[model samples]
Target: MSSEVLVEKRKLKNPPLNIHTLGDRVLRQSAKRVSKVDDEIRELARQMLQTMYSADGIGLAAPQVAVGKQLIVVDTDPEEPANQPIILLNPKIRRHSDDLALGQEGCLSIPGVYLDVRRPAQIEVAYKDEQGRPQVIVATDLLARVIQHEMDHLTGVMFVDRVENSLLLNQELTKQGFSKQAVKPVEAA
Candidate 1:
């Protein structure tokens, strides 16, 4: 994420929403475009961050909380109190580097399982900030990886579905008590 801008943390009266699991139908639904950025959207973002922190996650999407909206929250450095979590509404990757990298990825919705997935090493994204202002971020490394991962969730995709290692994926899913059928591969073998 771009270092210049800082997102602020917010307090919420409502509790965090429940995160759905891999096989849940909610996670497979493609999220709709956010029509308007309102108080509700900001509130949802706040609750999502809370849920993400509660789950020890660095990122989350609205679909993970059963909301079919194109919104995502990400914060790679949760330990840094000043490192506020980002709230992106209707996020779109404007550009991505041709260079690809294999990174270990995990999901709060698919807890207990992590997998290696190949994705662009960097990206430029355009979206609306919490206040409905236009914002763009140039992200690399973990921030880049996290943004791509959460963006997948908005499109009915999961990290395990991108795992290239079938053996490790199967073993991990089994040990994690997740059904192998839950994996819907995006790439053809």
Candidate 2:
């Protein structure tokens, strides 16, 4: 085959997909914690952000792209340019408010599934920024929800696991005409 053909074939091989549904081992396994901010990690973050934007998603976890690392990219500004993406490495919620709010949450890993998950109205997060500098950000409302949702991926937790009502899950399945068996029970470690 010609070089051009080879390049095209490689591109076709890695075509993006809406990572809905479950059974992907990457989504189930706990991601490894990132230790250092190296060029590779930064590049990975950039690529992840590109993938998320291409997929028209608000956030993405490393595991979603089959990278078992504690890294996530989120961009919630609908009107702003996509160049500014938030990268979180070794992120941890330092504090969360007692006030809880339920919001419809979705995930790139679990496509076609959205449910009302209860989360804190506000949270203080300590994480490494894109430059690998340690930074703490106080997030509220949707931003807080995005942070909590992505952090769960690092611990092998999906939004469905936090559903407030089982009926909501069933309703989503019914709407999609997908059987309930699609969501397998997450095995205990």
Candidate 3:
């Protein structure tokens, strides 16, 4: 397939300033499962990448843009210049190591917030590439954390749900002038 086919071509427009935040009703809803790979989905993925890159974020999910679909785009290559994006369709974490690490993470949806979130240090993910071809990749360190973080958004989970301590959450909220409240912990399966 051509490089053009591998990258989404559509441009995502900026959302209105009134776009919903983390506690909004739209974000909490379970995303719809994607059944087909079409031009629209591909375009949406492209737009997602554009929005993410514009916000200086490494990853973005469909729900973050108010579209509840099982899709995400990630680019964790810090060395590369802007615009290298990876599209993931129906991603699944097939294997994950027991070793855990805490990483400071932020989200595009929940802006001006950062917290230490615990995640597996390594993971093997299986998903369809941009061309709808099956691809499995083993990721460690930052890449693994990025994958896990984006995948959680597909399930309506946020980084705040995985925070290692309340102190970190409080610090983030206080910095943003938001009230501090206890967030329910994400149960490990």
Best by TM-score: 1
| TM-score of model 2 (CA atoms) | 0.81
Q: Please list the residue runs of candidate 3 whose C-alpha ends up more than 4 Å from where it truly belongs after superposition.
A: 5-20, 179-182
Which structure is stronger by lDDT: 2 or 3? 3
Candidate 1 colliding pairs? none
Clashing pairs in 3: 12-47
121-175, model 1: which lDDT tens digit per residue?
9999999887878999999999999999999999999999999899999999999
> Please, what are the lDDT tens digits per residue for candidate 3 over residues 1-189?
443434333334553223346666566667877788888878787667767766667888888778888888888852365445678888999999998988889887778998878888999999887677788989999889888888887888878888768787878877876555524468642
Q: Residue 21 lDDT in model 2?
A: 42
Q: What RMSD, rounded to one decimal, does every model reach?
A: 3.6, 7.4, 3.3
lDDT for 90 (candidate 2): 89
| Cα lDDT listed for each candidate | 0.86, 0.73, 0.75
In candidate 3, residue 109 scores what lDDT? 71
Q: Write the per-residue lDDT of candidate 2 for residues 67-108, one digit (tens) a residue.
A: 889998877863465335578898999999999998898876
Off by over 4 Å in 1: 1-15
- Comparing candidate 1 with candidate 2, which one achieves the higher TM-score? 1
Q: Which 10 consecutive positions of candidate 3 have the poorest summed lDDT?
A: 3-12
